[model samples]
Target: MSDPALVTIPARRGKAARVKQGQIVKVINTHGDQVVDTWAFNADDLNEFMSMEHTRPHIMKIMPAVGDAMLTNKRRPILTFIEDTSGGVHDTIISACDRYRYKFLGVEGYHDNCTDNLQAAMGELGLAAPETPCPLNLFMNIPVHADGSLSFEPPVSTAGSYVALRAEMDLVIAFSACPQDILPINGVGHLPTEAHFSVD
Candidate 1:
């Protein structure tokens, strides 16, 4: 094992974990219907990070599949989607939530958001966000409408449903237990909860 399963990512928070090449990382929604915004970077070079802009066209499928490789900005493989238990529903188009989003949504006061979550995790790794990038929204339900617009729906993953990815290169994986209650990304209460991560 390159790294053992780390601790539960607290509700409305995030963390960064290391997974070496050939190691597997699994993200689990223990409470069910929770969305985890995940980002990855090359451990040796943070600038060569995962890029949805490149991965989207390369795959040509909005919804990726098992064996599909999520690519980096330079079009290199980052992680291979080896297993998906929630019928492969995920998002590559949406960016992580930030404070501006809440303010735009008329949410009063300060809020814990995904952008900050990722930043915190990155800071821990002595890294920085050179640019804002869209993440792989695991278990998120954003359907492409007939008109090419998008619609949000509740996730179908039950408790214990998980997605597994094997690192293609040494990587620093970061994640946030999304904190978008108003968007209904987490279903009814919009209340966030703990999630699990294990490296094997």
Candidate 2:
């Protein structure tokens, strides 16, 4: 259970939320089937945001374990993976949901998606949305097999499982409660999830 002081919200599809610096945000899979793709940026300087290309090598080589610190593109500590209750926080290898991805998934006509949520969030914050980049797929199960293949499978997290991150700086966190219906990441259907924020 999270601390009572934490603010919790049910993140619906195509919506976004922001977290302040030094705050701890916990994304909880309230139900068994939801995918949350996350991105972080320096609130003061939007240019210093999470970069998939820069982070890929670290994620692949150092594979973040519980309590590992995730560094920003500027080589600054961004967040500490404090708690992984379900032991399954994925990497940037899995592509972030977007209009093109939806097209490939045969859901091109769907109006809701993770990219929309991210753009919406940026818009709300008066930040311009740039070319889409790969995002960290929180709660998504993308296993790297010994043969160097990736498999998108049902999440290892069950209902009530969560991953907690303590912000190392003033981070503008953006996320989409992914509405990816064509993959097992969403259990074949899109679902809502809960996000909790704690300021210590």
Candidate 3:
């Protein structure tokens, strides 16, 4: 029982912690073409965060698989995907990269986004984020077309691969190693590395 301390999430930067009810974060795409950008809140109610549009209608599906629980936006639940070796191809509809989405992806200055690395990782735990919610993009791949449209594709998760969640209550789990070098999600050589997490 020793090995549960990997916290990093660096590269473009952002990290956060404090999880309790059931604990078990995991998240480590270590080098698997990084694309973290997860989020959660509640920790007593920071406006009750976590909500990918209320978890895609309470997990009807847009990716989430291993058990699927994720709710919150007042819908409830919190987090509970349970585990995945990556390759579950996540991305419940994109919407994180900020700074006006790198100035409409043309980037002329200041990039490093993920909505400012989730408000500087919840202001280094001093706490803050009461807004930027719509994450859970872990290992993002974005591909959905057939007319509906959506395509940023890249990561299928490789290098180390991981994904696990469980804190369906006392939350506060932000992360964001996604600097997004101008699409390709985070690969195709767009480069934006660094990711890790543990919790247990």
Candidate 4:
């Protein structure tokens, strides 16, 4: 049996872990109204990583439903959504936040971002942070207009809500407990919080 594990991903930070093929990884929004940026890498080949680009077209969806498969850049199933309890509001089009993003927006000085969280998570796995991929923004609310424009809005998730995925391949998963405070992604500059991740 796969040893069960749970890691508390502190708000505004991130975490990484490995899961065997067929194991489940549950991303819990311990506190509602936060976004969890997520990515996955094939344990045998980092280059063949999860791609929201491939996932969207492959599944023909921006918001995945229960039973949807998260495909890799190579068009392979890496994870499958087995269950969701947040009305399936996950976003597939937004890229993870990076330091330059804040700087460009005139936020002076070094600011922690999803990129930093991703790096921290990667370090735990002893892997280099490869070119960042667009992530599956769990519980994030990116409102799209009729004119095809996008705007950030408060998330729709509630505390204790969660999404569960089953690994299709041996996987290395990375998560960024998003630290976006701008646009109040997590309420007034991303007040960090702890989230639960468990394998069963």
The lDDT per prediction is 0.87, 0.68, 0.85, 0.86
Q: Give the local distance difference test score of model 2.
A: 0.68
* Model 1 score (lDDT): 0.87
lDDT of 4 at 148: 93
lDDT of 4 by residue, 147-171 (tens): 9998887778888899999999998
Model 1 alpha-carbon miss at residue 157, Å:
0.8
lDDT of 2 by residue, 48-129 (tens): 7766667546655424556666766776777777888766656667666778877876764655677777787678677765
Candidate 2: minimum summed lDDT over ten consecutive residues — where? Answer: 8-17
Model 2 segments more than 4 A misplaced? 1-21, 59-63, 188-200
Candidate 1 stretches with Cα past 4 Å from truth are 1-6
lDDT by residue for model 1 (34-130), tens: 9999999999888888988899899998878898999999999999999988767899988888989999999999999999999888888788867
- Window of ten residues with lowest summed lDDT in model 1: 1-10
Q: TM-score of the candidate numbered 3?
A: 0.32
| lDDT sort, best first | 1, 4, 3, 2
- What digit string (tens of lDDT, one per residue) describes model 3 on residues 1-200? 14558878889889999999998889888778888888898898788888888889877878888998988888999888887998789887888878887888688978778788888888998988978887888888888889998888889889888988889788889898988786678888667878778998
Q: Which of 1 and 4 is the better model by TM-score?
A: 1
